[model samples]
Target chain A: MVAKTRGMKIVHSIEVLQHMLNRDERIGRTVGFVPTMGFLHEGHLALVEQARTQNDLVVMSIFVNPAQFGPGEDFEAYPRDIERDSRLAAEAGVDVLFMPTPEEMYPQDGGIRILPGPQATALCGASRPGHFDGVLKVILKLFNIVDPDRAYFGMKDAQQLAIIETFVRDYNLRTAIVRVPTVREPDGLAKSSRNVNLSEKEREEAPVIQQALQKGAALFHTGASAEQVEKEVAQYITEHSSGRIDYVSLLAYPELTTSSETSREWILACAVKFEKTRLIDNSILSVFSKEFPTQ
Target chain B: MVAKTRGMKIVHSIEVLQHMLNRDERIGRTVGFVPTMGFLHEGHLALVEQARTQNDLVVMSIFVNPAQFGPGEDFEAYPRDIERDSRLAAEAGVDVLFMPTPEEMYPQDGGIRILPGPQATALCGASRPGHFDGVLKVILKLFNIVDPDRAYFGMKDAQQLAIIETFVRDYNLRTAIVRVPTVREPDGLAKSSRNVNLSEKEREEAPVIQQALQKGAALFHTGASAEQVEKEVAQYITEHSSGRIDYVSLLAYPELTTSSETSREWILACAVKFEKTRLIDNSILSVFSKEFPTQ
Candidate 1:
């Protein structure tokens, strides 16, 4: 046996991790998992914290999935600081840090993928054609490898979290999901790895993405039309930030499907391209007619 | 607690089944599962035999999955004899029989599914679109519900077995798959659920499907070209049986992909349209070169 790093074991291969997990499972020790791309931040650590609180063991997987990135996407230039990530994860009380090579994860021609249904393919999937397919596929792989009782995801990517919830419900998977609130900087910028790519000026401008969503959400509570609120959110982000607006969508929360019913949850989601870095943020708003008063 | 039926317990809800499984798992009892569409025959019981020998507990789920059947297909008319199946299962040493209502299994819409890649969509999947999607989706649900150490599938549906094997491998699922050899009749007819739809004459003629594949295998071993083997197989089945040939295909085995390499494994598969019913059979061949001279 090797010396543990700060009471945390760093496993390189899936086989080693699974073997370790099998022993944990045999002893009936509950496992909680936090899956993330490398370059860990507070948002990712929030998920780890939730997992750490709930289970006997906490496993964090750092894999920059190539399948999720499209051509001209940042797969090549995606930030990688494995040593830093390891240190942070260890500090955050992660028990096992799983780091698998892409070749080991994907032995075949990467053809084996989980195709998302209409809900998963609505917002983010619309822009990135097969993005959720890769996300769901990788999550399935991670869940199998870790055999965690509960897995954590930050609500920063509410759409991704929703898709994963839907997949679990659909497949009747054993792994339960715990959605952690998004971790944000004091300036209100949602923590993301892509933030490192931001210029100093862009960093100051980034919080407007969330502010615009909040603006739309406030209007939504005041009984503004979806189209009107969407227009205002888009205009607000475009006007306040140096970033070009990718989209500011007002979608039904969780379902993400369009519904004429005003008595459902909603999300004001936005994406922006600030120089070389693209960032996404969203706010979940309960605008059910009974919950909010008309202006 | 309900009195056990012949030392076997039958469960109707997933909640109850999972509770029982959780209790059993706590005691370190290894579960073996055999998922099947009802109207249990020797073929299904053969799977149970394999399961019984290997595991401390055997669970046989009899669910005639509605999602798997197409609009024009026999979803409504599919043979189901739950009482007979239960009796047969008990006789075959099944410890638990899980039979869930469609509403419970698919509470929402039947839209949730596991889609297959190119390999699953090749031969049988081509003829029946979304069939394997439904097949895979149900199996995934069952796997989660059962959480079995091992699961069994008959080799009669080699394509289904292959697709499922790929899914298990790709997802790194906990359950290991046991590929049981096809249970055949004395006359060489592969047992299938659709066999009940066969007329007496059709039954006699159905064995030719297997015989034709064997003939093709013989010809293939004798250094006949793919064209020659395929033509002879199709011709032999057509001439000997009242059934019209649906497709008589010779393809590389396991991978099911095209290969010029003669050293690899191969499968001579055929599907025949017997009046209203379609039956399939295959023969695995290993013909690398002209190493063996004709007698």
Candidate 2:
């Protein structure tokens, strides 16, 4: 165990993390986990803050998962800064920061896979095929190793959160998934490590994602169809930003399914790709309410 | 919790089982798990006995997994004797018998899957496409639910055991996988619930599987190649039994790879198909040894 600032331990191997967690579990310490790809931002720090409040121990894993990236995707260009991440994690009161190498995490070709259901065919999953499978694969590995009492995910990636929620429930996993509201910049652009990759103009225009999702969600008050909401959101982003629209999806919340007449809750989500970055944002709303739902 | 004979509890719900185990875990009790498709033969009882001896708590789950059975297979006709199983489990000192219904186990279609690697392509896997995938899916669910310190599996399903071992290692699961030797009847037929499907004549001839494995393994003393061992085993079973052969495989142990000159440990395994039943057995041996390896 390597000691960081304020007696925080940084674990780089699975065996070491499990051993430490075993001791914590025996002592009845509730563990809360935050999984990230390093280059910590306010979004990740907010997750850590929530974890710090709920758990006796906070474990944060920073691994840039290769499997989650596709053939031409930015697996290589994904931002990583361990020194800065460690310092921020330490200041945020994380107990253990697990930083495992790709080789350490995936030592051999694992024949086993955790496939996403039809829930994966929309939003970001639609554009990046097999992305959720890779997300689930790494998450399952991290969950098995950490055995957290509760794990934290941001609602910025609403589709990812919904898929993971389904995965935990379907597998009967013990860990409770807590969804933290998305953290955004002063201008309403969702805070992400990739935000650093955005050019000045791209960053200035990125808040259009949140604005469009809110506008699309407001359409439901006029009893608009899901297709209308999607089209409205897509057109708004197209008019506002130089980014290419990956998708504009409005589906039943949590279930990530096409909404029917009886469906009460829905998620209006969108993803936009600029030259060097892809940004996603979402708004969850209940049609019963006249006003747009709170983040 | 439903109380059975001698204060043994039978839990039908995942939530209830987890609740009970949580208390047990808080007090630092070690849990031993034995997952089986129920029919409480000596083989399963032997696994229970081992669990009883090793851990403070013994949990045995008896659910005939529907996923593992291929199309037109005997999933519907598979043996089930819950009353007898419960009685035998209690008598053999099983602490908790988890008998969840198919509905309880599989409440919805789980999007997640655990696929096996190249190791699944030969032996019984050759004939049963998608069999190991199903095996891994259910086992992963059970493992997450039980969270045992040590899980027991019989060597009778050597290929399955090998696949599961790889899964556990590949995933870095905390549970220690305990390999229990195959239990046999006095006639040397490996004990299996499927054995009940055999006719009297088939039952009498099933011992040929073990005999054939032994013969093939002994030929390794003559520096026989894997093909030669496979051929010898296949010929012996054909000559001795009225059953048709499924496969006679000679592969590296645990790794389950096709053996080469550098391979020291080998698994000589075979499956025989009768009119109604398919029986599998294997013997693990070291080529460096002059005599056949023990069961």
Candidate 3:
């Protein structure tokens, strides 16, 4: 049956999804997937829309992958609106909506861990022990289950995006990885479902995250050293925002390595805590050499 | 073209395989796979015959998986006879003889590392740091590429088999793992292509590995404690055989945990060194109360 704009199939089990996918006869149809935690925002919608435009079949999975979340790290508090997500995905012309629960995604007594090496362990991997392992495991699971021709991920989660790319390359996954630009709010705050949980005061201050990233990006253009750029960004966020600065540093883009000179591809990433919510943002920073005209 | 014996078609790449296994087609055929490193032997052929009887289409992959070998390991020295292997496989009714080069299998740069966790660090995992990681990586790649209904593994590599099972369970792989009993020589030496490296004297002493495991199994049958069984096995191999004992122990089957009293399922495993060659062997030892005649 064709999934209309309003009603679509929601598969909770990997087996069920595989069975359904196996029944579809369109051999040449290019499949696109957008894997997400249950809550949906305009940023997620943009990803779905991009997938819809690029692929014959668009699959949007709303799984709050438990593996990606650290213990006492907003797993339970993570915003989720499946009904609204379904409506939005349908409006975006999604063909399938995979909504697997933690139990459905992770089998009982299953201890298989996929560790994305150095790339995972540098930035977020340093802070979280098994974080990227969880991310890689779930993403690999989702990729296998969906068997998409192309998969889309937002650049907002720059480290995660990079790790996924490495996983696909290392494993020789057949799916193409399409990275979309980060979607932001009018006030410069990155659009996230978690932003909905912010109190009025925290919400007002959330814009400072984007502003700090912008400032870091600007300083990088002035041939500033990575250390100098980081100092300025951290100071700006501390002075203007009510949040506690978790970390602010300029590191190599995709590689996530700490580099001094603004050459080739690099990123200025920062994380800040506002009461209970932790927000993160990053921007590409590089020298405007022949290799990278826009940088 | 239909395979003369089973009417199954031979396919090489993922595209060809998936073309045959189209979504709308009725997959009435049972697909069984035997992934190998070419240089086919009686042991590898035995696995193929088992697959032939158990499945409608028997796919035998002859790829010397580079991911499984260390930098100094004999990946290049590993024997290969593809033309001869193909003839033998076809004689054994293999539907597809998948022969892929190292380049074809791992097209990407060798920069990235895929790490399978803690379970990989126990026993052999300790001996070979990233050995099992390479095995798991290549096997997972083959599993995804083949997408077989059932995959066959010989029991000769007991630890490797256990790791494969762990991978399938942990990754929620849909393929069924069909483990075959280890094929052996008349003198009790387990058949391995690597056995070719053994000199005449080493070859004669090779049977000692099997003898140690059998002795350990006998001890378990006599209601001996795991510790006692291990000591007896190690002592016997050391005193009787010209080969040096690498390891000998009675442990929990599959889990590899050391045990004193033989439980429901136990593994009497041993590894020995004959000159420069290393040989390993194990047998399942099951202990049942006298009251339970069935067990």
TM per candidate: 0.95, 0.95, 0.85
Shift of residue A12 alpha carbon in model 1, Å: 1.1
What are the per-residue Cα lDDT tens digits for candidate 1 across A73-152? 89988999998999999999999999888988887641456777777666677788878877888998899888788999
Error of 2 at B27 (Å): 2.7
Residue B70, model 1: Cα distance from true site in angstroms: 1.3
**Local distance difference test scores for all models:** 0.84, 0.86, 0.76
Model 2, position B211, has a per-residue lDDT of 91
Give the C-alpha interface root-mean-square deviation per candidate: 2.8, 2.2, 3.5
In Å, what is the interface RMSD of model 1?
Answer: 2.8
Q: For residues A1-295, what per-residue lDDT tens digits would candidate 2 score against the true structure? A: 5666677899998887887887435476788999999999999999999999999889999999999999999998999888999999999999999999999999887476768888888778888998998999899889999988899999998888989998888888778999999998898888888898999998889989888988986786677777888899999999998989888887878777774455577888888889998888889887665533222
Ranking by DockQ, best first? 2, 1, 3
For candidate 1, the docking band is medium
Candidate 3 overall lDDT versus native: 0.76
lDDT of 2 by residue, B1-295 (tens): 5666777899999888888887435466889999999997999888988988999889999999998999999899999998998898889889999999989889987366767888898789888998998899888889888888899999999999989998888877778999999999997889999998999988989999999888887786677777788889999899988989888887878777774455567888988999987888999887664532222
The DockQ figures for the candidates are 0.53, 0.61, 0.34
The candidate maximizing lDDT is 2
- Which pairs clash in the backbone of model 1? none
